[model samples]
Each structure stands twice: as C-alpha cells, then as structure tokens.
Target: MAQPAARTGPGPRRAQDIFAATFALLTELGYDGLTVEGVAARSGVNKTTIYRWWPSKDALLGAALIDSRLFELTVPDTGTLRDDLHALLDQMRKLLTGEEAGAVVAAVLSAATHRAELAEVTRSFFLDRLGRELPLFERARRRGEIRAGLDPKTVIDLLAGALWVRVLLRGEAAPAGFVRETVDLVLRGVAA
Candidate 1:
C-alpha cells in the first residue's frame, strides 16, 4: 500500500501517523475488533493524541480510509472507452479479490448498518473514487467512442452494480474476463 503524501508545516506528521496506524489496524483486525488503544500501541502514539485528533473510532476509520491509498486507485485512459473501463474494472477486481479487501468491504458494510455517519463517509469515499472514472467516459463520448444517448452515471452504476452484487451479496470472487464482458455489454447494449 502507498503511504500518504508527506505533510508539511506544523503538527501534520502526527496526524498522518495516527491515520496510517488506524488504517493498518482496520485492515488487520477489522472494524468490530479494532480499538483506539490498539492503534496507539501499534502506532507508538498515545491515546490522548488519537482522542485529540478524532472524536470516535468511526471518525478515525473514516479519515484513515481517505488518507490510505486503499481507496486511491486511478483510472487509466487506454485511448478507447472499452479499454479504459476494462483497466479500471480490472483494478477494482484485484482489490475485491485480495486478501485484505474482503475484510475491508465487510467493515464498511457493517459500519453502514449501525452508523449512519460512517456510512455516509464510506459512501463518499466510493463516490469520490468512482467519480474519477466519469470524465474518461465523457471524453470518450465526445470522441464518439461510446454510443450516443448513453448516460455516464447510468453506465457507471450498471458496471458497479454488477461488481458490487458479486462482492457484497454472493461473496464470490470477481472472475477473470468479467470486466471485458461487462464493457462489451455496456457498449453494445443488451440487444441479442
């Protein structure tokens, strides 16, 4: 995992340390089993420092999600809309199928049911990541790479919905070649 960019100015390093440590713990122990005290021990930072930074465990986890590169995936432009979408989905498939990814997904979903605020934060995190891919589709539309009259948001949701169903409900690994088929279906439409 990539480290957060170095912070300049006063008191930034402490905050980064706390966030990094929190993310490490969350990835390891998960949301239900995580504790601030464990974060303090793992980070070598004091509990007072954590409390001073974040009010609650959820808040810390939220910030950690943002700070960590676990959600910092970049959508690549491969000159064609289908290729670009495939690249992005391939990255997501890797993430969803990884060892730590399952725990991370479960943690986010578990947080959503009991904690509205955390849910919102997690939603924002996903939206922010997905938002990065939208402009690629828009650019492709302008280039006539995608079919006209197709809504970018709808296309995005369509692809994401399929992947999420597999990840969240079925708990099955995203199969290889799934992204290619999805991109083909999206571009060509559902017509036989």
Candidate 2:
C-alpha cells in the first residue's frame, strides 16, 4: 500500500526507480502525453536501458505495473464463498485506493481504448490475475456454496466489472459498505 520510491540513479534498484518514475509521470501527463524520454529524464535511467527491458512505452508501463505488486492477489480460503469473496474484494479495494497503483490502473485503462498494445497489456494482466483466483470459485462450487452452473469467469467479470465502474467510470471511491453489498448480491444470485 506504500508508494514506490523514485530512484535518483540507476543500479540494482533501477527498475523500481523507473517504475516509480513511470507512475509519477502517468499521474502528471497521463498516457497519451507520456514518453520514454520523459521517464528516463525523471528516473535518471538511460532510455536505451529502458528499451532493452521493454519494447515500447506500453510495455514499459505494463512492466512498471507488475513491478509495483499492485496486481498481486491471493485468494482466501475462509470456509465459505461469501467470506472468501469479501476478503478478495477488500484486497481489491486496497489496490484501487492505494497510492500510485490506483492512478497507474486508471491511466492504463484510460489508454486501452485508443492504444492496442496497451489494451492487450491491460487485458492480459487482468485475465492472468483472474485465472489465479479461479480455483476459489471451483472450490466454492464443489462445496455447494455457489451454484454448480455458475461460470467462474462470469463471477469474476461481475465482481471486477463493478469495481471498474465505481473506480474508473464513476470517478468515486466505492461507498463504505459497497464491497459487502456487492458480495452479498453476487452470492445470493450464485449461491446453492
């Protein structure tokens, strides 16, 4: 939940510095106006070094996101689907509200529309993360906490889609209790 520290010079910690710089630039210039030259200037890393690591600006941003650990998730096993989902949602709330990470997510999502590479990067990142959580849904189905017919993908989309609506489109933090309410609704519909 802590913001990454920006690097003043390149070394073993160069990537973190670049990532910090990238997020800072994203907040300042947005996706469209951001440039590798700008990032290099800010991070004190050479542009060629960045290019060696990432092929494009979008790729660099995606690497920065991964390096930030903002997208990392661990599905909880709390003996019931409802409890599990609440934990997952709560973690997601942190990712959305935490410094640097939230702004990076917003910038990437905003850029995905007109930038194909960025769209792919964003989609791939989410899909990969969701895949990691699928076993939770499978476990719930086996335990009959959720209906057997429910698709895990649909459930993931619903949960994450609602988050995107609140965080990205609405430009508001989800109201207090929104996570619990949303989990309850999804559970009611999918519960056995």
Candidate 3:
C-alpha cells in the first residue's frame, strides 16, 4: 500500500511564524512583559508547541533576534571611505530614530542583566551582523581613501561606541549631522 504524501513546509513555516510573532510581541511589550502564552496566542499556536521548540522565552527571542532582518541596515560602498561612512551613518540615523530601536535596546538590556543565554545571543548577533562593516574600513585604507595604519576594529568600536554612549548613557538621540562629523573627526584627528 502507498503511504500518504509526507507533509512539507509546515514545520519551517510554523517556526518562521513563531519567530515573527515573538519579535512583534517583544517590540510591543518589553522582554519583561512578554510571555510564551502571548506569543502562542498571537501566532495561533498552542503554548505546548512553543515550548517544544524553545526551552524558554529567552531562547525563542534570541532565535528571533538573529532571524529578523530588522538590524540589517544598508552599508553602501561608494568607492570612497568618506562617502561610504556618510551613507552608513545616514542609515543609522534612520534606525536610531525609529520606535522599534528603543524597544529592542530595552529588551536586550533587560535580557542581558537577567538571562546569560540571551546576553550571549545578543552579543553574537551584533558581532555577526554589524561586524561586517569593518571590511568597508579596511577597503578604504587599502585604497588610500582614509589614512593608513588605521585599525578597522578600533574604528568600528569608536563609531558604534559613540552612538551607544549618546543613546544609552546620555539618553539623547543622535543628531542628523552626527555621523558625518563623527567620520571626519575619527579620520582627521582634532587639531589646535
């Protein structure tokens, strides 16, 4: 006897739906406010189904963090370091100004303080996705677009660190001209 046709697409599609729902819920409600039950309700899946895939909400959200293309900002290569940096900064300005950013920041911070796995996942996601920008700096240096002897990692840190300081520590939003000015200051050191 011929067996019934094997089911296809349901597992992967359901997983994607779950991740998307989790991200949406995280954005709407901070990590502390999120719950598996809410995600199940939102995704139309039973709570047991969520538990079977993800051992905890942190794990589910962690997976969602990597899956979501929300942080995939455009990093253009304009054949010149200055122009490329400016374009990247412009994209950052748009991201930083968005409502979702605040929510993401809050969720990550809260998770970091309470959940070790979540913190690791967040760090890994940032390093994997954002770290690619380092190559842009390296290319600029090789092409003599920017000063030689510059450390790509250091430069990336400075760029992201400054923005983080402004947003997380100072509680101020990045201004429109901040990115251009930042690139200039970093490339050409301050002078008396």
**Winner by TM-score between candidate 3 and candidate 2:** 2
The C-alpha lDDT values of all candidates are 0.74, 0.81, 0.74
Residue 11's lDDT within candidate 3 is 75
lDDT against true structure, model 2: 0.81
Off by over 4 Å in 2: 1-13
Residues 1-192 of candidate 3 have per-residue lDDT tens digits of 999977342376787788777877887887777899999999999998788768799878777776655556777889877777778766766666677765676667766888788888788777775576876876776786656566666766777678777776677878868878887887675111
Residue 104 Cα positional deviation in candidate 1, in Å, after optimal superposition? 1.0
Error of 2 at 83 (Å): 1.1
TM-scores, all models, native as reference = 0.80, 0.83, 0.77
The regions of model 1 sitting more than 4 angstroms off are 1-20, 27-30, 147-149, 190-192
- Ten-residue region with minimum lDDT total, candidate 1: 7-16
Which candidate, 1 or 2, has the higher TM-score? 2
**Top model number, lDDT:** 2
Residue 27 CA error for candidate 3 (Å)?
4.1
Between candidates 1 and 3, the lDDT winner = 1
lDDT of 3 at 73: 72
